[model samples]
Target: MRRSTGHPRVRWSRRGAAGLVVLLALALLAGCAAGPSQRPPVAVRGELLPAAPPPPAAQAPADPDRLPEAEPLRSGPPFADCTDDVLAGLAAAGTPVPEGRTLRIGCGRLTVPADRNRPDLGPARLGLTKVTAPGAPADLPALVVLGDTGVDGSARAAARLAAQLPDPVLQRYQVIGMDRRGTGEDLLDCAPADARAALLDAGPERGDEAAMSALLERSRSIVQDCYLLLGGQLTSFKAAGSADDVEALRTTLGLARLNLIGVGDGADAAAGWVAGHPGAVGRVVLDGPGDPTLDEPARTEAVTAAAESAFDAFAGACATGPDCPLGPDPRASVRRLVDRLSGTALPVGDGDSLTAGATLRAVRTLLSQPSRWPELQTALAQADAGDGAGLARLLAPLGGPQGRFDAALATRCNDSRVRATPGEAAARAADWDERFPLFGVAAAQDLVACGPWPSGGQVAPATPQGSALPPVLVLGTAQDPRAPQSGAERTAEQLGNGRLVRWEGAGTGAYPRTPCVNAVVGRALLEGRAPAEPVVCPP
Candidate 1:
C-alpha cells in the first residue's frame, strides 16, 4: 500500500508464473531484425508525446512548490568531438544500414570480459548502436544512453529517440544503446515461441497455493536449466557485467566522459557503472529507475501501490466521459470484468477466444503509455459489447517486457538477492492480495520469479550514493506503477551528487510530458548546473 519504488518494469508486457520456462532460442524480436528501418526503442521531444492534448474538463493544478532554474553546461567536457553540421548531416541523410539489430545507425560490437571484475573470465561481445547528434562538436564529447532490455530491442530505444530528441539535445550528443549481455546478438534465449501464452496460463494464480507451488517449481527448474545450459556465461548477464560493458563502450568510442541517460532498470546499470568509474561519467540523468536500495518485499509493495494508483487514474479518466464503457464506477467495472472472466472465454473476432489472462495483459499494455488511455477505453467498450477483437489486437504484438521473460527473471534475480521458497512467495502474495487486489498479489508472486534460481547478480548495487561523478538529474513519475517516483527520490538522495525532479503526470519517464519537465531536463544537461534540491514538474 505504500508508494511504489522500483524498476521501469512495464512489468507491462511480462506474463505470470505459468510455464514461464519456455524461453525459445536466441534470435531478434520479431520486428527488431535489421532487414529494414523500423521505429526505434525510446526517447523524447515527447515521451511518446501527445499531439495537441485535448483540454481535460478538470486539469490538475500545477505544483505549488518552488521550482529551480536550470544552469549552463558546467561539466568537465563534452563526451564527443564532432561538428554539429556533420552530425546533423548524418541524421538528415538517415541512418545507414546498421551492422547489428537496427538499420542506419552506428552499430558496432564491443568486446569485454564476460565478467569484467574477473578478467580471466574471458571475452564477451556486446552489440551497440550509436545515433550521432546532428550538430555535436567532434571535439565536444557527448553520449545519451538507452538501456537494452533483451526484450526491448537494445538499439530500438536509441532509434526511437534519434528522431524525437530536440535538435539542441541531439546536436549536443550521440544517443547510444547496447544489447544487455543476453538479448540482442549475444542472445542466450530459451523462451519458446508461445512463451507469452504459456506464462500467462501457467503463472501462479492469485490465492491458489497449489498453482503458486507449481509455478515456483517450474521457476526453479528454469533457472537450473539456464545454468546448466549457459554455464558461467550466465554470470555475465548480471547488472555488474552490463555496467562494466558500458565502461568498455566508452573506451571503445574513445570518449573521456559520458553524459548518461538511463531509463527503468537501465538507471541501475548506469548508476552501478558510475559508482565504480565516476571519472568516466560527466552529466547523468536517471528516469524511472529500479533503485537497488529496495529489497524484494519492498519492491513488490511499491510496484503494487504504483500500479493500483495508475489504474485508478486511468479509470477515473474514463469515468468522466459519459459514454465510458467502464461506466461511472470504473474501479468496480474493472473488478467486475476480472471476476466475470475467471473461467469463461469470450469469442474474439476470427473465432479466437479471449481469456482473462489476455484481458489483463491488454490493460497492462495500455497502462504503460498514458497516451494509449483513449485506446484502452475503446477496447474496454468493445469487449463489453461482446467483441474481444480490440483486446486481442492489443495483446497480439506485446511480448513480455523489453527483454524476454526468462532474461528479465535472470537479470532481476541476479540484481535482487532476495530468496523465498514458493510457499513463502505464495504467503507474500496472499498478504498483498488484501492490500492490493488485482495487481498486488500477482506482482508480489512475480517478484520472486527467480527464487528457484541459485545464482545471484555479481554485486548488489550499493546505496545509490558514492558516485565521484557530478550530480545526476533523477526524474520520477509520481503516479507511475512500473517505475515508482519513490525510487527516483532515493536515487537522488543516495547519490553523492544527485538532484530529484518530480513530475506528477502520466508515462514512465515523463521527460516530454510537459514543456516544464523537458525544459528542466534539457537545461540541466545542456547548460549544466545541477539543481541542488528537488523540484516538482506539473503535468
Candidate 2:
C-alpha cells in the first residue's frame, strides 16, 4: 500500500485485477478478526460514506374499533316522473296518501335482474316513492325508508313516515320508500284453498300427534306446490338480492351515499346493504331489526320467548284496568281462552275457525302494537264469549300491500336456509309448546312450511365485519313481539360499527314512538354523531 489511502482507485489492467483480489482477501481476514456490526461502510471516494438509515419501524394496522366518519352525500340525477303511476298504484291497492304538507312527490320503478346470480330469471321491478315537503330544499339528501318485508307497501310506508317524522328531519332530507321485488302479487296462490285453510288449524291440542301430523302434511303440500308453481322464480326472492336492489336504487337516484331507516324485516335488508357497501352508507337506523344470522331454531326460540314475555307485559298492563276483558289475571284469561279454543274451535265466518294457531297469531300481532292492546282485549273478550269473529277480524290481511301473507311466507322461507323436516318441526313444536306454552307451538309448527322450500341457497343477507363503515344505530324494543330485543342486540354486535339503543317498552319498534329513541336517532342522522355508550329508553 503506497500511502495506505482509505479509498483507492484501481486501474483496469491485469496487475490491478490481481492486486484487487489480494486486497479483498486481506479485508475479509480483518473483518473476521472484528465483528460485522463494528465495520464501517466502504467509502466511494477519499471520504467515509454514511450508512443507510435502518428500515422504518413496521407500523401497526389501523384500529378496527374506530368507525369511519360520515361524509356529506351528493345529489345525483333527477328521478323520473312516476307520480301518476305511483298514485294510481296506491289507489288500486286501497292505500290512502299520507296526510302531511307534501309539496311534491316523485315515483319511479327500477328494473333489476330477478336473480343477479342467474341472468335467465329475467328482470324484476322495484317501486320507488320520493316525498318532498313544501319548505325542504331541492338539493337536500335522500332518506330511504324500508318497511317490514311482505306486509308494508314502500310508497305508502314512506308517505306515512314523511307525515310522522319531525319537521326538522324532513326539512333536511327527502324521504324515499322502496318496494322490494316479488311483491304486488300473491305467490302463495299456488297452494290449494283447502290446504291453506287446513294449515291455519293450530288446535290439535299439544301432544296430539295426529293433529300435528295433519298440519305438517298440509304445510309440506302448500310449500311444495308454491315451489312447483313458481319454479326458479321462487328462488329469485332473496333478502340478499334485495340488498343489491338497494344499491341499484341508490345508483339510479344518483346519491353519493344513502341514509336509510329499516323497520322490522326491512332492517335486515338495510343491514345487508351496509355490510356489502360500507363506503356508500351515509347514516343508518335499524328499528326492531331482525337478526338473520340466527338459525331457524334459534330464531324461533328467541321470538317465542320474546312473545311470551310480551304477552306477560300486555296482561300486566291490562289487569290494572277495570275494563280489561282479560279479567284480573289477563294471562290466566288468555290461557283459558287458548285451552277453550283447543277443545272446540270457534267459527269466525268465511269458513275460518279461530283455532289455537289463529288465536296465537292474532295475539302475537297485537302484542307488537301497544296502541292495539284494546283491540286484543276486545278479541279476547269475544273469544271468551264463544264468538271467533273478533279474533278473525284481527287476522284480516294488512292494508298496505296486497298478498301480504303470501309474500311474508315466501320471504321468510327464502331468507332462511334451515328447513326442518316434518319430524323435526313436530319435535321443535312440542318443545316450544312445553317451554313457551302460548306462542312456541305455532312458531315451531310454522317451520314445516319452510321444510319444502329449496335449500343450499344463501340464508338471509350477509353481515360483514365492517371496520371502516360509519356508525350504525340499532334500536331494540325490550318487549318486541316480532323481532325481539335480543335480535337487535345481536345485530348491533354483528355490525362492528353498530351502536345499540334499547327501548324498555312493549312494541315492535321504538322510533317515532319514544322521545328518547327519537332523540338518539335524530342526533345520529341529523348531527352525524352516534353515541359511544349504549343508550336505554324508558317506556
How many clashes does each candidate structure show, in the order listed?
A: 44, 0
Candidate 1 structure quality by residue, lDDT tens digits, 1-539: 00112312221121111121222211212322212112222211111112332221211113322122221233221122222322343343232222332223555545556664544435665555566644344443445565635225454455555555666776666566676766554554433333334344332255466666666666665655555444455555677777876776655444556667777677778778777765555667777776557777687688678888888889887888767767888778767666666556677544356766567666765675676688878877777777777776666444333335556667777776677766777787788878877676567557546667664653434544333446678888877767688888777666656678888886566664578778877776677666666789886
Model 1 misplaced stretches (Cα beyond 4 Å): 1-104, 117-123, 132-140, 148-151, 184-188, 192-196, 202-205, 321-325, 347-353, 396-403, 458-467
Among all candidates shown, the one with the greatest lDDT: 2
Task: Give residue 102's lDDT in candidate 2 (0 to 100).
Answer: 52
Best by TM-score: 2
Q: How far off is residue 106 in model 2, in Å?
A: 4.8
lDDT of 2: 0.65
Predictions: Cα RMSD each: 11.9, 25.1
Q: Which stretches of candidate 2 lie over 4 Å from their true place?
A: 1-107, 184-189, 204-210, 398-402, 456-467
